[model samples]
Target: MYIATYIIDIAALIYLMGLLYSNAALNTSRKKPFLIAIILTIVIILSEAGTVLTNNGSLNLRGINIVCNVLGFILTPMIPIAITLIFSRMILTTHKLLLISTFINIVATALSPIFGFIFYVDANNQYIRGDYFFVFIIVYIINLLILVIITLEVGKTNNYPIIGKLVGLSIFTIIGTSIQIVYPFTYSSWHCVTLSLLLYFF
Candidate 1:
Protein backbone atom coordinates (compact mmCIF):
# COMPACT_ATOMS: atom_id res chain seq x y z
CA MET A 1 0.00 0.00 0.00
CA TYR A 2 2.76 2.39 0.95
CA ILE A 3 4.57 1.43 -2.22
CA ALA A 4 1.55 2.42 -4.28
CA THR A 5 1.10 5.59 -2.27
CA TYR A 6 4.70 6.78 -2.67
CA ILE A 7 4.65 5.98 -6.37
CA ILE A 8 1.57 8.17 -6.88
CA ASP A 9 3.11 10.98 -4.89
CA ILE A 10 6.17 10.75 -7.10
CA ALA A 11 4.02 10.78 -10.23
CA ALA A 12 2.23 13.90 -9.07
CA LEU A 13 5.56 15.49 -8.15
CA ILE A 14 6.93 14.77 -11.59
CA TYR A 15 3.93 16.62 -13.04
CA LEU A 16 4.83 19.63 -10.94
CA MET A 17 8.35 19.42 -12.30
CA GLY A 18 6.97 19.52 -15.82
CA LEU A 19 5.67 23.01 -15.14
CA LEU A 20 9.21 24.18 -14.49
CA TYR A 21 10.74 22.42 -17.45
CA SER A 22 7.96 22.47 -20.07
CA ASN A 23 6.60 25.94 -19.43
CA ALA A 24 8.15 27.22 -22.63
CA ALA A 25 5.81 25.26 -24.87
CA LEU A 26 3.01 24.69 -22.37
CA ASN A 27 2.65 28.48 -22.29
CA THR A 28 0.57 28.09 -25.48
CA SER A 29 -2.90 26.57 -25.90
CA ARG A 30 -2.12 23.93 -23.28
CA LYS A 31 -1.49 26.39 -20.46
CA LYS A 32 -4.96 26.63 -19.00
CA PRO A 33 -5.79 22.95 -19.13
CA PHE A 34 -2.36 21.91 -17.96
CA LEU A 35 -2.56 24.21 -14.95
CA ILE A 36 -6.03 22.92 -14.15
CA ALA A 37 -4.83 19.33 -14.22
CA ILE A 38 -1.75 20.17 -12.19
CA ILE A 39 -3.91 21.80 -9.51
CA LEU A 40 -6.29 18.82 -9.42
CA THR A 41 -3.33 16.42 -9.18
CA ILE A 42 -1.99 18.36 -6.20
CA VAL A 43 -5.36 18.06 -4.50
CA ILE A 44 -5.34 14.34 -5.24
CA ILE A 45 -2.03 14.15 -3.45
CA LEU A 46 -3.65 15.66 -0.38
CA SER A 47 -6.64 13.36 -0.72
CA GLU A 48 -4.35 10.34 -1.01
CA ALA A 49 -2.44 11.52 2.05
CA GLY A 50 -5.67 11.56 4.00
CA THR A 51 -6.58 8.10 2.82
CA VAL A 52 -3.13 6.84 3.81
CA LEU A 53 -3.38 8.26 7.32
CA THR A 54 -6.87 6.88 7.76
CA ASN A 55 -5.78 3.40 6.74
CA ASN A 56 -2.76 3.59 8.99
CA GLY A 57 -4.95 4.16 12.08
CA SER A 58 -2.05 5.80 13.89
CA LEU A 59 -2.80 9.53 13.90
CA ASN A 60 -6.41 9.49 14.88
CA LEU A 61 -6.95 13.20 14.76
CA ARG A 62 -10.68 13.81 14.50
CA GLY A 63 -10.50 17.19 12.83
CA ILE A 64 -7.96 16.06 10.32
CA ASN A 65 -9.99 12.96 9.66
CA ILE A 66 -13.17 14.86 8.96
CA VAL A 67 -11.43 17.48 6.91
CA CYS A 68 -9.68 14.86 4.85
CA ASN A 69 -12.81 12.89 4.23
CA VAL A 70 -14.79 15.91 3.09
CA LEU A 71 -12.03 17.18 0.85
CA GLY A 72 -11.30 13.78 -0.61
CA PHE A 73 -14.93 13.15 -1.29
CA ILE A 74 -15.34 16.52 -2.90
CA LEU A 75 -12.17 16.40 -4.94
CA THR A 76 -12.47 12.94 -6.42
CA PRO A 77 -15.21 13.93 -8.85
CA MET A 78 -13.34 16.94 -10.11
CA ILE A 79 -10.59 14.94 -11.80
CA PRO A 80 -12.93 13.74 -14.51
CA ILE A 81 -14.29 17.23 -14.84
CA ALA A 82 -10.88 18.78 -15.27
CA ILE A 83 -9.84 16.07 -17.69
CA THR A 84 -12.92 16.65 -19.75
CA LEU A 85 -12.27 20.34 -19.77
CA ILE A 86 -8.75 19.74 -21.01
CA PHE A 87 -10.08 17.71 -23.90
CA SER A 88 -13.11 19.86 -24.61
CA ARG A 89 -11.57 21.79 -27.45
CA MET A 90 -10.49 18.64 -29.17
CA ILE A 91 -13.91 17.03 -28.80
CA LEU A 92 -15.63 20.19 -30.13
CA THR A 93 -17.92 20.96 -27.20
CA THR A 94 -18.18 21.31 -23.42
CA HIS A 95 -19.68 17.80 -23.26
CA LYS A 96 -23.09 18.28 -21.76
CA LEU A 97 -23.33 14.86 -20.17
CA LEU A 98 -19.98 15.11 -18.46
CA LEU A 99 -20.61 18.66 -17.33
CA ILE A 100 -24.06 17.90 -15.96
CA SER A 101 -23.04 14.70 -14.19
CA THR A 102 -19.99 16.28 -12.63
CA PHE A 103 -22.07 19.23 -11.53
CA ILE A 104 -24.43 16.85 -9.74
CA ASN A 105 -21.48 15.25 -8.04
CA ILE A 106 -20.19 18.63 -6.95
CA VAL A 107 -23.56 19.53 -5.48
CA ALA A 108 -23.86 16.23 -3.64
CA THR A 109 -20.35 16.44 -2.25
CA ALA A 110 -21.06 19.91 -0.94
CA LEU A 111 -24.01 18.53 1.00
CA SER A 112 -22.26 15.40 2.22
CA PRO A 113 -20.62 16.93 5.24
CA ILE A 114 -23.90 18.36 6.40
CA PHE A 115 -26.14 15.40 5.62
CA GLY A 116 -23.63 12.57 5.52
CA PHE A 117 -25.28 11.53 2.27
CA ILE A 118 -22.03 10.16 0.95
CA PHE A 119 -19.81 9.72 4.02
CA TYR A 120 -19.23 11.00 7.51
CA VAL A 121 -16.66 10.89 10.27
CA ASP A 122 -17.71 9.79 13.71
CA ALA A 123 -16.67 11.03 17.12
CA ASN A 124 -13.61 8.83 16.92
CA ASN A 125 -12.73 10.50 13.61
CA GLN A 126 -12.58 7.17 11.83
CA TYR A 127 -13.84 7.29 8.26
CA ILE A 128 -17.35 5.95 8.05
CA ARG A 129 -18.98 4.99 4.79
CA GLY A 130 -22.46 6.36 4.27
CA ASP A 131 -25.63 4.84 2.83
CA TYR A 132 -25.17 6.60 -0.51
CA PHE A 133 -21.62 5.40 -0.74
CA PHE A 134 -22.54 3.76 -3.99
CA VAL A 135 -23.30 7.17 -5.44
CA PHE A 136 -19.62 7.75 -5.93
CA ILE A 137 -19.28 4.50 -7.81
CA ILE A 138 -22.28 5.25 -9.97
CA VAL A 139 -21.06 8.70 -10.89
CA TYR A 140 -17.63 7.44 -11.84
CA ILE A 141 -19.07 4.65 -13.90
CA ILE A 142 -21.26 7.10 -15.78
CA ASN A 143 -18.32 9.36 -16.43
CA LEU A 144 -16.18 6.54 -17.76
CA LEU A 145 -18.98 5.19 -19.89
CA ILE A 146 -19.63 8.58 -21.38
CA LEU A 147 -15.95 9.00 -22.09
CA VAL A 148 -15.68 5.62 -23.74
CA ILE A 149 -18.77 6.20 -25.82
CA ILE A 150 -17.36 9.48 -26.91
CA THR A 151 -14.06 7.87 -27.69
CA LEU A 152 -15.70 5.27 -29.88
CA GLU A 153 -18.26 7.53 -31.49
CA VAL A 154 -16.20 10.61 -32.21
CA GLY A 155 -12.91 10.56 -30.39
CA LYS A 156 -9.70 10.89 -32.31
CA THR A 157 -8.74 7.63 -33.96
CA ASN A 158 -5.49 5.80 -34.74
CA ASN A 159 -5.11 7.77 -37.92
CA TYR A 160 -5.64 11.05 -36.12
CA PRO A 161 -2.69 13.05 -34.89
CA ILE A 162 -3.29 12.67 -31.11
CA ILE A 163 -5.15 9.38 -31.19
CA GLY A 164 -2.60 7.27 -29.42
CA LYS A 165 -2.23 9.64 -26.49
CA LEU A 166 -5.96 10.15 -25.94
CA VAL A 167 -6.63 6.46 -26.30
CA GLY A 168 -3.93 5.67 -23.77
CA LEU A 169 -5.22 8.27 -21.29
CA SER A 170 -8.81 7.06 -21.51
CA ILE A 171 -7.93 3.38 -21.15
CA PHE A 172 -5.47 3.74 -18.30
CA THR A 173 -7.68 6.14 -16.34
CA ILE A 174 -10.69 3.86 -16.70
CA ILE A 175 -8.72 0.86 -15.53
CA GLY A 176 -7.36 2.68 -12.52
CA THR A 177 -10.75 4.06 -11.57
CA SER A 178 -12.36 0.65 -11.95
CA ILE A 179 -9.78 -0.93 -9.71
CA GLN A 180 -10.27 1.64 -6.98
CA ILE A 181 -14.04 1.27 -7.23
CA VAL A 182 -14.02 -2.53 -7.07
CA TYR A 183 -11.44 -2.79 -4.29
CA PRO A 184 -12.21 0.46 -2.50
CA PHE A 185 -9.14 -0.27 -0.40
CA THR A 186 -6.30 0.33 -2.79
CA TYR A 187 -4.85 3.79 -3.37
CA SER A 188 -4.04 3.69 -7.06
CA SER A 189 -6.43 6.06 -8.81
CA TRP A 190 -4.28 9.11 -8.17
CA HIS A 191 -1.26 7.53 -9.79
CA CYS A 192 -3.25 6.53 -12.81
CA VAL A 193 -4.76 9.98 -13.05
CA THR A 194 -1.32 11.51 -12.75
CA LEU A 195 -0.07 9.27 -15.50
CA SER A 196 -3.04 10.03 -17.74
CA LEU A 197 -2.59 13.78 -17.42
CA LEU A 198 1.15 13.49 -17.87
CA LEU A 199 0.50 11.63 -21.08
CA TYR A 200 -1.78 14.43 -22.15
CA PHE A 201 0.72 17.17 -21.39
CA PHE A 202 3.82 15.52 -22.77
Candidate 2:
Protein backbone atom coordinates (compact mmCIF):
# COMPACT_ATOMS: atom_id res chain seq x y z
CA MET A 1 0.00 0.00 0.00
CA TYR A 2 2.88 2.31 0.71
CA ILE A 3 4.61 1.47 -2.52
CA ALA A 4 3.90 4.92 -3.89
CA THR A 5 5.32 6.49 -0.79
CA TYR A 6 8.45 4.43 -1.06
CA ILE A 7 8.83 5.31 -4.72
CA ILE A 8 8.44 8.99 -4.03
CA ASP A 9 11.08 8.73 -1.33
CA ILE A 10 13.48 7.16 -3.78
CA ALA A 11 12.78 9.90 -6.31
CA ALA A 12 13.55 12.52 -3.69
CA LEU A 13 16.81 10.77 -2.94
CA ILE A 14 17.74 10.88 -6.60
CA TYR A 15 16.87 14.55 -6.76
CA LEU A 16 19.17 15.25 -3.82
CA MET A 17 21.95 13.27 -5.42
CA GLY A 18 21.66 15.31 -8.61
CA LEU A 19 21.75 18.54 -6.67
CA LEU A 20 24.91 17.49 -4.81
CA TYR A 21 26.77 16.58 -7.99
CA SER A 22 25.64 19.56 -10.06
CA ASN A 23 28.69 21.69 -9.13
CA ALA A 24 26.46 24.51 -7.99
CA ALA A 25 28.43 26.94 -5.87
CA LEU A 26 26.25 27.80 -2.90
CA ASN A 27 28.44 30.65 -1.72
CA THR A 28 25.93 33.48 -1.67
CA SER A 29 24.05 34.41 1.50
CA ARG A 30 20.79 33.62 -0.29
CA LYS A 31 22.09 30.27 -1.47
CA LYS A 32 23.08 29.38 2.07
CA PRO A 33 19.43 29.44 3.14
CA PHE A 34 18.63 27.27 0.17
CA LEU A 35 21.20 24.79 1.39
CA ILE A 36 19.60 24.82 4.81
CA ALA A 37 16.23 24.23 3.25
CA ILE A 38 17.60 21.22 1.43
CA ILE A 39 19.08 19.81 4.62
CA LEU A 40 15.78 20.26 6.45
CA THR A 41 14.02 18.52 3.60
CA ILE A 42 16.38 15.59 3.99
CA VAL A 43 15.62 15.35 7.69
CA ILE A 44 11.89 15.55 7.06
CA ILE A 45 12.19 12.81 4.46
CA LEU A 46 13.92 10.48 6.85
CA SER A 47 11.49 11.23 9.62
CA GLU A 48 8.58 10.59 7.28
CA ALA A 49 10.06 7.33 6.04
CA GLY A 50 10.66 6.11 9.54
CA THR A 51 7.12 6.94 10.52
CA VAL A 52 5.68 5.16 7.49
CA LEU A 53 7.76 2.05 8.02
CA THR A 54 6.89 1.81 11.67
CA ASN A 55 3.24 2.51 11.05
CA ASN A 56 3.16 -0.31 8.53
CA GLY A 57 4.66 -2.83 11.01
CA SER A 58 7.89 -3.08 9.09
CA LEU A 59 9.65 -1.74 12.18
CA ASN A 60 8.83 -2.46 15.79
CA LEU A 61 11.16 0.00 17.44
CA ARG A 62 8.63 2.07 19.32
CA GLY A 63 11.19 4.51 20.61
CA ILE A 64 12.39 5.24 17.10
CA ASN A 65 8.81 5.55 15.93
CA ILE A 66 8.05 8.16 18.55
CA VAL A 67 11.21 10.05 17.75
CA CYS A 68 10.45 9.97 14.04
CA ASN A 69 6.91 11.27 14.52
CA VAL A 70 8.17 14.02 16.77
CA LEU A 71 10.79 15.03 14.27
CA GLY A 72 8.30 15.07 11.41
CA PHE A 73 5.81 17.24 13.25
CA ILE A 74 8.37 19.68 14.56
CA LEU A 75 10.58 20.05 11.51
CA THR A 76 8.02 20.22 8.72
CA PRO A 77 7.21 23.85 9.42
CA MET A 78 10.86 24.83 9.61
CA ILE A 79 11.33 24.22 5.89
CA PRO A 80 9.20 27.18 4.88
CA ILE A 81 10.77 29.24 7.63
CA ALA A 82 14.16 28.43 6.13
CA ILE A 83 12.82 29.37 2.71
CA THR A 84 11.85 32.73 4.13
CA LEU A 85 15.46 33.23 5.15
CA ILE A 86 16.39 32.90 1.49
CA PHE A 87 15.31 36.49 1.18
CA SER A 88 17.92 38.31 3.22
CA ARG A 89 16.26 41.58 2.43
CA MET A 90 12.99 40.55 4.03
CA ILE A 91 11.87 42.68 6.96
CA LEU A 92 13.53 41.73 10.23
CA THR A 93 10.18 41.85 12.01
CA THR A 94 8.78 39.25 9.68
CA HIS A 95 11.77 37.01 10.31
CA LYS A 96 11.30 37.31 14.06
CA LEU A 97 7.62 36.53 13.79
CA LEU A 98 8.24 33.42 11.71
CA LEU A 99 10.93 32.24 14.06
CA ILE A 100 8.59 32.70 17.00
CA SER A 101 5.91 30.61 15.33
CA THR A 102 8.37 27.84 14.54
CA PHE A 103 9.66 27.87 18.09
CA ILE A 104 6.14 27.47 19.40
CA ASN A 105 5.59 24.49 17.14
CA ILE A 106 8.88 22.94 18.20
CA VAL A 107 7.97 23.25 21.83
CA ALA A 108 4.50 21.89 21.37
CA THR A 109 5.64 18.92 19.30
CA ALA A 110 8.55 18.13 21.57
CA LEU A 111 6.23 17.96 24.55
CA SER A 112 3.60 15.99 22.71
CA PRO A 113 5.09 12.58 23.45
CA ILE A 114 3.92 12.97 26.99
CA PHE A 115 1.07 15.40 26.48
CA GLY A 116 -0.22 13.97 23.20
CA PHE A 117 -1.17 17.45 22.11
CA ILE A 118 -0.05 17.13 18.50
CA PHE A 119 0.41 13.37 17.95
CA TYR A 120 1.25 10.09 19.61
CA VAL A 121 2.13 6.54 18.81
CA ASP A 122 -0.16 3.82 20.06
CA ALA A 123 0.77 0.47 21.63
CA ASN A 124 0.48 -1.16 18.22
CA ASN A 125 2.97 1.38 16.94
CA GLN A 126 0.31 3.17 14.97
CA TYR A 127 0.57 6.91 14.57
CA ILE A 128 -2.34 8.92 15.86
CA ARG A 129 -3.19 12.58 15.58
CA GLY A 130 -3.85 14.54 18.72
CA ASP A 131 -6.39 17.22 19.44
CA TYR A 132 -4.02 19.98 18.40
CA PHE A 133 -3.21 18.52 15.03
CA PHE A 134 -4.83 21.58 13.54
CA VAL A 135 -2.06 23.62 15.08
CA PHE A 136 0.45 21.92 12.82
CA ILE A 137 -1.77 22.38 9.79
CA ILE A 138 -2.30 26.06 10.47
CA VAL A 139 1.40 26.71 11.03
CA TYR A 140 2.34 24.85 7.88
CA ILE A 141 -0.19 26.81 5.84
CA ILE A 142 0.87 30.19 7.25
CA ASN A 143 4.52 29.52 6.53
CA LEU A 144 3.71 28.41 3.00
CA LEU A 145 1.72 31.57 2.42
CA ILE A 146 4.60 33.60 3.76
CA LEU A 147 7.01 31.78 1.48
CA VAL A 148 4.88 32.71 -1.55
CA ILE A 149 4.55 36.30 -0.41
CA ILE A 150 8.26 36.72 0.31
CA THR A 151 9.23 35.25 -3.00
CA LEU A 152 6.94 37.64 -4.83
CA GLU A 153 8.14 40.60 -2.80
CA VAL A 154 11.81 39.82 -3.41
CA GLY A 155 11.28 39.02 -7.06
CA LYS A 156 9.61 42.41 -7.54
CA THR A 157 12.26 44.24 -5.53
CA ASN A 158 14.96 42.83 -7.76
CA ASN A 159 12.82 42.89 -10.91
CA TYR A 160 13.43 39.23 -11.47
CA PRO A 161 12.36 37.97 -14.86
CA ILE A 162 11.55 34.54 -13.41
CA ILE A 163 8.83 35.65 -11.03
CA GLY A 164 6.46 33.43 -12.94
CA LYS A 165 8.76 30.48 -12.34
CA LEU A 166 8.77 31.25 -8.63
CA VAL A 167 5.00 31.46 -8.61
CA GLY A 168 4.78 28.19 -10.46
CA LEU A 169 7.01 26.50 -7.92
CA SER A 170 4.92 27.89 -5.08
CA ILE A 171 1.72 26.67 -6.69
CA PHE A 172 3.22 23.26 -7.22
CA THR A 173 4.17 23.09 -3.58
CA ILE A 174 0.70 24.19 -2.48
CA ILE A 175 -1.04 21.62 -4.62
CA GLY A 176 1.29 18.83 -3.64
CA THR A 177 0.92 19.46 0.07
CA SER A 178 -2.81 19.99 -0.20
CA ILE A 179 -3.28 16.57 -1.74
CA GLN A 180 -1.34 14.93 1.06
CA ILE A 181 -3.30 16.87 3.66
CA VAL A 182 -6.64 15.79 2.24
CA TYR A 183 -5.50 12.20 1.90
CA PRO A 184 -3.14 11.25 4.68
CA PHE A 185 -2.34 7.95 3.01
CA THR A 186 -0.60 9.80 0.21
CA TYR A 187 3.09 10.64 0.45
CA SER A 188 3.67 13.37 -2.13
CA SER A 189 4.35 16.48 -0.08
CA TRP A 190 8.05 15.98 0.50
CA HIS A 191 8.54 14.85 -3.06
CA CYS A 192 6.90 18.03 -4.25
CA VAL A 193 9.10 19.90 -1.82
CA THR A 194 12.17 18.16 -3.19
CA LEU A 195 11.17 19.09 -6.74
CA SER A 196 10.59 22.67 -5.68
CA LEU A 197 14.03 22.82 -4.13
CA LEU A 198 15.58 21.48 -7.30
CA LEU A 199 13.75 24.10 -9.37
CA TYR A 200 14.75 26.85 -6.96
CA PHE A 201 18.39 25.81 -7.17
CA PHE A 202 18.36 26.16 -10.92
**CA RMSD of each candidate after superposition:** 3.4, 2.7
The residue-by-residue lDDT of candidate 2 on 1-202, one tens digit each, is: 5556656665665666566556467556766677678777778888888887777474457778999989988889878767677765453564566666767788889998899889988787778898998888888888888888888888899999998998888888888988987898788888788878877767
- lDDT measured at residue 78 in model 1 versus the true structure, 0 to 100: 64
TM-score per candidate, chains pooled: 0.78, 0.86
- As for candidate 2, its clashing pairs are none
Q: Candidate 1 — which pairs collide?
A: none
Q: Model 2 residue 102 lDDT?
A: 67
Q: Pick the candidate with the highest lDDT.
A: 2
The per-residue C-alpha lDDT of model 2 at residue 75 equals 87
Task: State the lDDT of candidate 1 residue by residue for 3-101, as single tens digits.
Answer: 566656666656576663667754445466556666767766776676567643655566666667667776777666556655455433655545566
Q: Where is model 2 poorest over a 10-residue stretch in terms of lDDT?
A: 88-97
Error of 1 at 44 (Å): 1.8
- Please give the CA lDDT of all the candidate structures: 0.67, 0.78
